[model samples]
Target: MDVTTRIGVVMNGVTGRMGYRQHLLRSVLAIREQGGVPLSDGRRVLLEPVLVGRGATKLRELARRHDVEHWSTDLDTVLGDPRWQVYFDAQLTSVRHKAVVAAIEAGKHLYTEKPVAETARQVVELARLADAAGLRHGVVHDKLFLPGLLKLKRLVDAGFFGRVLSVRGEFGYWVFEGDGQSAQRPSWNYRKQDGGGVVVDMFCHWNYVLENLFGRVRAVTAKAVTHIPRRWDERGEPYEATADDAAYGIFELDGGIIAQVNSSWAVRVHRDELVEFQVDGTEGSAVAGLWGCRVQHRSMTPKPVWNPDVPTTERFRDQWAEVPDNAVFDNGFKAQWEQFIRSVAGDGEHPYDFYAGARGIRLAEAGLRSSAEGRRVELEEIAP
Candidate 1:
């Protein structure tokens, strides 16, 4: 027989797409279905989720639909409860700060979605609060845990990309402008007042990906634009799209590596995946996306002559070899949840802590600043 310890987690903002699909359904419920997370001492830690949100009807429906035992509309009441030891936030960026502050004051361990707060300052403050309160805290860095990126990381660790030179990343897809067609994203995503923009949303992911795999970003030069100026809201009402739908950024890393990434919600993707990164090095180069990775070594690289009147004759994409998935990978959200649960259960601390979250926000702020001023911005150390 195995001993099981049930840990309660206050899950906020599960009504949203990512929150509902990834965090609630795919992660917590899936973890529960799998007989809980196993511990080293032959003990298992089960996650008991208490769904918390502003909408009572929606929360109740979701709770009942998923067979969740606890559901609450009152965050204050939920925070005061001793049963829930962990607080997980996937709320809107604008309102995240206050809710997280309240949760921290309640002495709950924190786990949150990216861009932890609207600004870098708020994230640092939260980090300090969690640190002072002696609470374990972590932020979502799901991209790094993807199988493709995991393989990329393995190659890096094995010195496959010797003397890394540069990295190029493309991420985006066409989002419908709710006029004749319905917008896939919420109307808030097009409004700057709502803390929405490609820079704010995607830069955080890029920052972590770059730093964790390559090096820390030292400086950034970026241009952000609202390609789709006019858009209709969810209610079929016309409104000015105040947020930038597209952003192009060039980052200078600590190791003199240059990384260029283009993020856009208005552009159509031509690649195999929605997001792809090509890392070029002296030894070899690799292109990795959410699910696939292909590599081309320096020795195997093909050379083509540039001619104005000649037709190109090369299977360029097919030249690269596909990387194999040697091991099974769990859902990224679930994996992170398990790790956070283990941390809260007295295991070692989670590496993607509040400080790491702050750094991601710092990069986002820097990118926005660079775009606004039309000048390259250098990253400065932020402290609480």
Candidate 2:
């Protein structure tokens, strides 16, 4: 029989969409279902999440639903408690810095959502603080854990594509223009002051994806556009859209791989999900979606001349085939949470730590600057 390691979780922003869905329901409660993570030394890692939020009623409801007894509206009280060694933050982008800095000062190992801060300087400062405190840290780069992305990684590792050439990412969805009666997303997402915008939100994912699958971005040139100027809120009131609705950026990776990422809030997605990546190499290529991957390759270097008159069948349109789902894990976000818990238990390393998170934020910051200046921006310029 293994003894269980008691872990007290200080979870902030429990009421937010990502916080509740990924952290509360999937990570903490789902781990309970597996009887906790069993260790080889006859010990188990038990997660006890102490929900922290502003609303007492919602916290109480969440606690009751999860059969968790601990809930608190006072963050100071929770942080002062020595029993809790890990502090998790999923607050809005604007509040992430303060919450994380406080957690670090309290000497708790930290895990939080992406875009560590709005600027590269803040991210670097946080990383420095975490290192000085000697606390373990991780950030949510959940896209890497997606089954499709994981499969792409496997292909890359196996050298299926002899020499990687380029990568493309497409992410977007139709955002409702706020009319008098339209149901709009939270207003903050459309306002620059609120840290709401697709560039900041989605580019962080692109950074991790490019870093993990391809390489680090050395420089970037981008163009951002605000396609819609007005939108209606859920309250039947109109608000001005002040943020960019679409962003197109080209990245030069470390090894000469040119990567392009397109992010938009106003584009209509014909696919079930609005994210996909395509990788091209000298010998082969692969296209990955949320559910699966398809591969195309030249078995022996077959050459073909450009022919506009050729039919779709002659262009190897059907050459691509679906790769089997090799993952037996839960959702990507849940997998990341489980890993974070395991790492906190001193069993292994957390893959996306604070440094990685900072890098993503730096890339995003550079993207914004490039769009604003209408020129190329070097990663070294924003390098912490």
Candidate 3:
């Protein structure tokens, strides 16, 4: 007795790069192709997305391209409709709060991209609203679902790395200056007024990674800087890069774990992956990238003597063993989407909700504050 239930969703901000590629194309469409999300009781939840955005032309194009039955430029009308049960947002950080608030008022279960709002206060307010309305709400925690990180978590869970010590993370690559070549990232990413900055964007991610894998973040000391003074926009117009393009942060996690992460858009890549983390512990150590992970256990630890006079002979990089994927890995965004859909259908509670999103925002705020004041900022528990 398998039953397929169609869940209508109002999807806003599909015109943006992340919204279009990851959410619309990869996650939602891929789920539909897979015959929806399966429940334990032989039931399936099929998503029906109604594309909503500011640009009618873009929405119409996307709807037609995806063969979506419904598309709308009028968010109010779409929100007022009782047919749509869920609302998903991948909008800009600056404008996300209002739309999320409206969706909650309309009684739609919420699923959204991180930094749910510009500030911690706003995210807490949204969490309260969703709770009051008795709706399922979730913020994306995609990085945890990454294959490399998943393997890292598996090792941690298996006690492979007994008594974790510290973590070092490196993320980012050079963005072409608009003057010589077109910038890879959006121009707004370098503008502070539009909620742009490496600290605001990356600290949110670092906070969750540290909190989930190691321990909750206790304090943060960060240095944020604008390395490149000016860059060209999409239209080839020159503008001052007012926002910080780079951030070097030291986070103190619970249980005496120290995590250092460097996020930048100005640095050149010298590693296999754009983002990588090296976790050191008492028993073992591991280096994990976006898709690959290598580990060196205590039993196989290599000891080399430092000799500056002669050429180094030890192949340090080749010493670690690669971590294999024990199971098939789904697209991170798609997996999270399925989980959120299940929660909306009363399968179970979504773990990364608005409250979690607020904590990320708080971390970003703390990092920025620390940079501005030249001091360490301690994290305060946010009331759920």
Candidate 4:
């Protein structure tokens, strides 16, 4: 695979966890090591990712460790370079709007993490700017590329569900208190001032999952709670947690489908997977997790009569059949990156653009409003 042409990408915030592990190391650099991504006509698209961040020490160590040749602390210098065609942002959600806007203005294609901006208005503005600038852009909708969800989507497309009645999503894991156990997440995640909250974080993911797998979300009724009031910061200083630790939401989607999601940083894991969606339909039911999906057809579904007098012997978990993992699955983020690169190369089209990102933030905003007002909030699309 001797490829002559290459696509230079400016990747900001690559020193962070998601940026470093998922975007930089696994996706971009991995593609680089593989020579290039193959196209249908026996062509290859080479990716050259330049790491950009604030700290030189972190950048130096990261670049050295990951075999990255280019590293820069000044973002403006990187953006000004004509070689870099794409600007990928994985920075803090608060800072992404300005950086992405700058990239769009620079005539660079854009790709970034979820919640493109802290507000839905900002997302719409960015989308409009990208469109006006005639630059192609995409946002991370990594969940859609996951193997389990793909299987579930296949069931829906094959009409195995008949008619979806409702969907139940359980997504959460215990984040250790900074008292004696070190917190797994960044310290800023518990602070509202830093743009942290369960509803804002999780609902963005749920929005696409619901819309893609079931239907478009129309309204939401939500309740949020800050279960932990005080927590230790990165420096071991105690601080008041201003953001919501947990959020329970009920969504009304098109076709009268009901979707319920419970997102928390306080709940312990007791299920088969960290995140699971149990979808009930008229003809059958299926439960899809992060990597696996199980289905129980109506014919195979057991019927249990209400009987308190006699001890039950029927095993519930044994009835469902596991969806076969017949295909090799790649990392979800990498899967999306390949498609985005193909789209950027003018070899394909991508739909998960800024408009999709705006839709995600729109749902998050509606969930927050519903929780605050104690009423159902209807989604209103913004025209920018």
Error of 4 at 295 (Å): 0.6
RMSD of each: 1.3, 2.2, 0.9, 1.5
Question: Which residue pairs show backbone clashes in model 1?
Answer: none
lDDT of 1 by residue, 1-384 (tens): 648998899999999999999999999999999999888788899899999888999999998899999998899999999999999999998899999999999999999998899888889899999999999999999998899999999999999989999999999999999988899899888899999999999999998899899988999999999999999997899999999999999999978999999999999989999999999999999999998899999999999788979888888998999999999988998999989889888876688888889989899889999999999999987644
Q: Let me know the TM-score candidate 1 reaches against the reference structure.
A: 0.97
lDDT of 1 at 206: 91
The 10-residue segment of model 2 with minimum total lDDT is 178-187
Q: What does candidate 4's lDDT look like per residue over 1-384, in tens digits? A: 555469999999998999999998889988888878777667888998889999999999988988778999988889999999999999999899889988987889999999899988888888998989888889898888788899999899999999999999999999987989988887788888998988888898999899888888989999998998989988888899999989999999899999999999999999999899999999999999999999999998888998999999988889899999888988889889889988888888988888888889998888888889999999986544
Residue 51, candidate 4: C-alpha displacement in angstroms: 0.7
Alpha-carbon lDDT, every model: 0.92, 0.83, 0.93, 0.90
TM-score per candidate, chains pooled: 0.97, 0.94, 0.98, 0.97
Tell me the RMSD of model 1 versus the true structure.
1.3
Regarding TM-score, does 1 or 2 come out ahead?
1
Give the higher-TM-score candidate: 2 or 4.
4
Model 1 scores what on Cα lDDT?
A: 0.92
The segments of candidate 3 whose C-alpha lies over 4 angstroms from its true place after superposition are: none
